[model samples]
Target: MATNAEIAGRFEEFADLLEADDVEYKPRAYRRAAEHVRGHPRPIADYVDDGDREAIEDIDGVGEAIADKIVEYVETGEIEELEELRAELPIDIADITRIEGVGPKTAGKLYRELGIETLDDLEEAAEAGEVQEVKGFGPKTEQNILENLEFAREVGQRQLLGEARPLADDVLAFLESVEAVERCEVAGSIRRWQETIGDVDVLVATEDGEAVIDAFRGWDSVDDEIESGPEKASVRVGEIRVDLRVVVPEEFGSALQYFTGSKDHNVSLRNYAIDRGMKLNEYGAFDVSNVEDEVAGQRVGERVAGETEAGMYEALGLEWIPPELRTDRGEIEAAANGELPDLLTREDVRGDLHSHTEWSDGNNTIEEMVDGAAAMGYDYYAVADHAEGPGIVGGMGLSDTEILEQVEQIREVDAASDIAVFAGIEANVDAEGEIDLSDEVIDALDVIVASTHSALDQDAETATDRLVRAIENPAIDVLGHPSGRLLNERSGLDFDATALGRAAAEHDTALEVNSNPRRLDLWGSAVQAAVEAGAPIAINTDAHQPSTLEYMRWGVHTARRGWAEADDVINTWELEKIREFLH
Candidate 1:
């Protein structure tokens, strides 16, 4: 059976191929349906398996034609149309489109003109100066393609946190159901919620390692078994590779700690343990203060801790560090000093500070979005649709007049709504850090989220200055996705996080950790810098549809990685407090 991500991924491919083939409106529909499909809480595959066509179509933004394709895909494990598109293009459409400025149409053009079918071919052409000779291709455009080709290759090598995390969840769900398994958890970058991960690492505790390993290897979701042993197994699930290591229940915690590592963090932790006359490893923590033979064996000293992860840290007289904070960025020292932050949890978030609807490129109505937020039990929500500005193609953003009109609609919705609905705009910060909105329009909005959607290639100093200028804007309540980075796609603006953080703090502007899987901007270290500077943070979904509102979970974990506490996040505040801050 296909996962939602897999099924949605198919639709996304379909959209790309359609666009590459120059089919216009259909590509948008397919893309919209893909977004909602990925966001839909229910398994679209289940409906198809049960022969429930009506239920499949019930998913928002899924129309009859697309739903039919989805059903065809779920039932047959392939969509005929998608296969036809793939055969027609016969190029790596997905990989080529990942180039920073390369779109589906551009990929199509490249293929038709230069016979470029892969990144290697494109790179070869660009290097030979052949790309610039092609129609519509300039030296700068060729340079961009060359610059981002490595990023595209890197993207193929790793998985986005959003894409990989769900697979981890499913793996855990299966592992937990095994009777022989005493405990199971994801480790590695996924555990720390890094924006991109190499693979999914799962640690299992069990007396019967063979049974657990067998169960893992035989799991239904396993697309291919790479290798398996009595104690461990590696399997492929779609594009994600999952590795499971089973250990004795007593050593589970230590094994988890050993595996859930940023190499630097583990190295520092091992040295820290050594300083305290303790030895830490995958087996357990042992007190070696009294041991005479320093290199006798692996367990030369008395075992002090191992049964539980908390005990492993507790034995060292430190607060058990949250996995997200295990980045070795002073976390061990902070733990020793009893200064580990009380990190924010999902429950601490009181409202969504950024979201969208049909007013822009969003797929839902304002009422529908507000209801979705209310359903999440939020005290408030902000409908900050994109405002017309740089890089906002297709006239998708709201014009000044349209923004006020939407404000009126938002006000009307707020009047009949159960929660406070704040009308806001995600205004684009231009090359020079100026917002596209007028002073009057800026003042009219309740909260202004200024972001950079263009000029992401600016040098560090220029980028930092641009962001600081935006932060200084009194009406700009939040600097959204301050760096504008897209995981595995583009490393956006190179800016000084500390400087940007301090500027935001001084201007009372909050920094946003965009929860969209592609853009967890202000990711970790950046957010940490902002929080350290006393600047507030907002974990927003940047949700374009109602179902995507659940992306807040990713955002919350991202904030934790940045060591943000509930108080550091503005959306965690009460309604009155947020209103006061906005004012």
Candidate 2:
């Protein structure tokens, strides 16, 4: 059966194709339906598989037409209408539009005028000066595409952590049920909680390697078998490639440590070990201090540690480093000195201060969203709906009057709610680094998460200055999705993190690590820089619906990757403490 995410992805593609085809109004409707489909708590495919069309349509924003298409998809494993759209364009619309300035409409025009379908075609056209010759495109546009095409192609090869992690969890759950598998854990960049990963790597410990491999091959989500052996196998799951390796129980820890690495980190750690007469590898850590002819083999010396990851670190006289901090950025030294940060965990967060409701583009009402937050055991929640500005379109943004009206409603809901409902607005930052809201509206909001939604192509210096200026504004409490980057899509802004952070710290404005999978902005390195500069951080879901509020998990891991401690994230503070910070 198709997963909710998979079903929603098809509709997203449907919307993209329709927009590329220049179909009016239908694109937004499809996208809205797709959002609700993705955020719906229950499995939409289950209802379709059960032949209950009414149940499928019961989901918000899902009408009868979409219900029929979903049923077709669940039953036949394909939707005829969507397939027709693909056949009509016959272009890699999604990949092509990944270019910085290229949207679906531009993609459709290019396909029609230049017969461009793939990145190769686009690059070829740009290189031959043919793109500039097209009526609407100019030399600058052609150059921009040429400059950004490589980045786009590279992005296509990697999957977002949010998308791949769930699949990894599924694989783990399946492996745990196999009688022959003794132990299993994810490794590689996925284990490190990297923002993006190339593939999923699973390491299992089992005496019966063949049985483990056979059981893995039998998993239902396995889309295709790429290759298999007695102790290892690689398979294609959906679009992702999952590699599994089976080892003896004794080698499981060493294997996991060796695989769950940033190459630089491993190289540094190896040199550090060698300096102490020790050698480390996948098999085990060995003390070669008294051994002669040390180059004989991996087991030339007495084994010091082999069975547990923490023991491996203990043998090195260091603390066990979390996987997220395996970035080789002084983490080894920090661990050796017992100075590694106590990274913030999910439970440390007291509330989410960035969220949306029906006042803007969100699907839920303020009351419904607050109830959802209360159910999640949050002490507070903020309704930061979009304010009228650039990038937010189609009457989706609230005017001054609408914002004040929403604030009143939020307060009314807050009066009866278990959690403190803070009134907020996701105000747009113009090119000049100024929010468009009036002082009255700004004052009324408890939190103002100002973000750059337009003119994202500003140069590094200008972008940094713009962000700093926004930070200097007293009304702006956080700079949300600081770079405006959409993973695998727009490259968004370029800025100096240290400068942005220092300015944020000076002005008491927090930096946000947006939890929306599409935009995990202020990514690990940038977050590190900001935190180092003493800027407060906010890991918010930027959730548009109740189900998406659960996105806080991704945000927490991302913050950990940045080395953020509980005190660094304002959302983790008590209600009174956060209120003081807001003031």
Best by lDDT: 2
What is the Cα-based TM-score of model 2?
0.75
RMSD of 1: 18.7
User: 1-583, model 2: which lDDT tens digit per residue?
Assistant: 5655567888889988899899988987787777657544345665765678887888756898988888888788899999989999988987998776689999999999999999999999999999999888999899889977976886665798899999999999999999988899999999998887878999999999999999899899998676789879988787787999999999888888999986657777888998998989988899999888636887768898978888788889989999998876679999999999999999999999999988888999999899889888999999999999998989999999999999899889999987899999999999989989998897888999999899987765677789899999988999999889898677677677878888988989999999988888877877888889999999999999999999998999988988999999999999999999994
> Backbone clashes in each candidate structure, one number apiece?
0, 0
Residue clash pairs of candidate 2: none
**lDDT per residue, candidate 1, 379-411, as tens digits?**
999999999999899989999999988999999
- Model 1: weakest 10-residue lDDT segment is 35-44
Candidate 1: which stretches are off by over 4 Å?
1-155
Least accurate stretch of 10 residues (summed lDDT) in model 2? Answer: 35-44
Q: Give TM per candidate.
A: 0.74, 0.75
lDDT for model 1, on a 0 to 1 scale?
0.86
What lDDT is reached at residue 511 by model 1? 89
